[model samples]
Target: MKFTTAIATAILASAAMAAPERGLASRVKARAAAARGSRPLEAAQKPADTTNKTNVQYSSNWSGAVLENPPSASATYTAVTGTFTVPEPTGSGSGSSSASAWVGIDGDTYSDAILQTGVDFTVTDGEASFDAWYEWLPDYAYDFSGIDIAAGDEIVAIVESYSSSSGIAIIENKSNGQKVSKKLSAPDSSSHLGGINAEWIVEDFEENGSLVDLVDFGTVTFTGAEAKAANGESVGVSGATVIDIAQGSQVVTDVTIDGDSEVTVRYV
Candidate 1:
């Protein structure tokens, strides 16, 4: 009934996405704004009201861009570089009328945009909150993809953990020049006897509560990653950089934004 758990919701979202309805972005943005205290009208809405739609509107500072090697354009769902896919879950909660359970549902993955730590991407402020769904794709899952993010003038590394999930997933502090890892928690709850596909993964975040601050790779003592930005020898964690292939290193540090931790780029 309560889809506040990550594992419970991933099962429903794991399935492939169908064609996106036109003007869905605007609707999502409007809904997100309303949820974040920006209220919108709902009672006046009509049943046959499928007319014009608007683009998602956000405050100027809320905008962002990502660098990605995207999938075929024709595909309904595009797994941009920073974005990952989730396989449909087998177990869900769809029972009889007398014994029914319902969970929240949301389906929005990261888009193609180059983002880094401390860049006001994941958590714009030291304290921010949102109600939504997310997934966690660590290094082991993406082959160490989306690693070495920066906040501003730091090595882009931090340590954080999840509250509860059937399994464990955490990022650690630094060790040597590499970002060493330690015990981290994750939310892997799958509810409804794991037999539905319309539940949601819910998230709640608070500032400085089990939070870990991270620095960019250059600022860290032992990061093998080096930045190749035109402005500086190293791009700060917050600065934007492209996903270069000629950088001589195919081994990217493990980064996790699959929705486990509140922070985006954690050190593990």
Candidate 2:
């Protein structure tokens, strides 16, 4: 089964109408024009061979830690949460660069759907800007208004899947004591969540049908990272797979998981 084009169109239209303004509309519109949002890892290599080893993979668009295999075969991840300090993105030259850090469920091993939210940091001609947003892929991200974010601000992102077809995405600006959330539903039955994998990712997302230039987002560390399964078990990044961003021949990011509850990604 596939998402009905008519229904998807209506949903997008409704979301656009309800979107916040004050230059936010243009930002959201720019994102909505993208081909896709947060996506599954495009692994460049296979997993490592050592037991209890950190399986390191490389992707063109994503760099972070993913809990792909659940502890229990019957358990499906239903909720994921993480907190990070917004990075100060530095511009390389006279162009725009962007990146986003988010926590999501079911986009790694199970790619049919993803429930996620986070903040996007961008640098244009040496000026920096931040926008908080939520996304349910394959739909584009929508900006969350009324929450002000800046470099050094602490942010907590949470995504919860109530069912295959329903979920919620939340972003809390802990530094400023502001919060925003949205309850979302799958565009169609075929776009339902699989709830198999959970991830804390720093991503170079698509814009205008191409991957945008990733800014030098010095470092982002996801702390208090946790995922809850449908069977009521909670897990961390202890045994998760680590991924780094590799653009062409040179890897651009470094990912490391510290203990079980922390994952850090650094731009190289």
Best by lDDT: 2
> What would the per-residue lDDT of candidate 1 be over residues 162-248, giving only the tens digit for each residue?
221211212221221323223322222331011011111111111222211221121112122222222222222222211111112
Candidate 2 ranges with C-alpha deviation above 4 Å? 1-25, 34-36, 45-54
- Each model's lDDT: 0.20, 0.86
Report the lDDT of model 2 for residue 192.
91
Candidate 1 has what TM-score?
A: 0.19
Q: List the residue pairs that clash in candidate 2.
A: none
The TM-scores of all predictions, comma-separated, are 0.19, 0.86
Query: After superposition, which runs of candidate 1 have C-alpha atoms over 4 Å from their true positions?
Result: 1-63, 66-153, 156-178, 182-186, 189-205, 208-268
How well does candidate 1 score on lDDT at residue 121?
20
- Per-candidate Cα RMSD to the true structure, in Å, reads 21.8, 10.4
Instruction: Tell me how candidate 2 scores on lDDT.
Output: 0.86
What lDDT score goes with residue 178 in model 2? 99
